[model samples]
Target: MFRDEGYDNDTLEDEEEAIMSSAIPSKVDPLDFVYTNIPDTTHILKLDANCKHCKAKKIVSETDGFCCRNGQIELKQPEPIPELMRLWSSMDADSRHFRENIRFFNG
Candidate 1:
């Protein structure tokens, strides 16, 4: 998106006045890390942990009852998605990709 210097004269703006300067520091308010509108984060974490445990328990119960008949059963704990997975999940393959993946959108 390079601008053509022929049509757009940058000299005009420079001749008028300089805009805001970030170099001169001003006392701006710091960000509020403690959000008020959102629910308790600790409670949310606990709920998420409990939900995962419940799902695993349910899977094990079903597997033990149905599949593990020969007494040779190995319950494999699913490998957790690492931090890098966020990049692929959030940026590379976004909501549009997910919507298509889950059949929420027409192919």
Candidate 2:
């Protein structure tokens, strides 16, 4: 009876591990705060914002405009809304619910 109980516990643990391993991992988009695209013609701005890449001050000056304080940071374009929504929908219900509750400044 003890051996049977041990075997059952082992089976349950294996099943739990398999379920966790097969579950889809949650994804995080770094550019969730960006609401609008920065126009190609508007490279330099007087506004104060953090660089999406390095989390440093975004702009310097009009004459010596730089993306970051060190002028080495580069921004990445966000995934298209439809593609992001598709991925979001594919996630497990619990993950989707958790992500849906997250609030971003832009929206």
Candidate 3:
């Protein structure tokens, strides 16, 4: 069975207060942040040539040379992941310890 109608009113008020408190922080300044220029979807689309798909710029017909050639495109100069791994492995013990300390403090 439910409680009296008046008891539900008090319970609802308490729940609303708890939700509002959690939503806003104790210390916050509205003026601390400034709004920059609004986003322009049209300009962004123009900047990044839509060669990504078969619709932006077509070299041949409306179905061919849209994205690079066709099929899968190959990288001109592939990144050397192995060299990066070797460099990371060569880090001194003190540097590694400092990185771990920083991570712990941040977390």
lDDT of candidate 2 over 28-83, digit per residue (tens): 45575684575667545665666554656544452233545455656677877874
What is the C-alpha local distance difference test score of each model?
Answer: 0.46, 0.60, 0.59
What 10-residue stretch in candidate 1 is worst by lDDT? 44-53
Q: RMSD of candidate 2 to the true fold?
A: 20.9
- Segments of candidate 3 deviating more than 4 angstroms: 1-7, 35-107
| Tens-digit lDDT string for candidate 1 (1-107) | 34566645565565343444444446643554545467655532222211233233233224433444433555687886674356336645564476456544434
Q: After superposition, how far is residue 43 of candidate 3 from its true place, in Å?
A: 32
Question: Relative to the unseen true structure, what is the Cα RMSD of model 1?
Answer: 16.3
Per-residue lDDT, model 2, residue 13, is: 82
In model 3, the Cα lDDT at residue 77 comes to 67
Per-residue lDDT of 77 in model 2: 73
Considering only N, C-alpha and C atoms within 3 Å, which residue pairs clash in candidate 3? none
Candidate 2 off by > 4 Å:
1-7, 26-42, 45-107
In model 1, pairs of residues that clash are none
Assess every candidate by TM-score. 0.20, 0.22, 0.25
Least well predicted 10-residue stretch by lDDT in candidate 2: 58-67
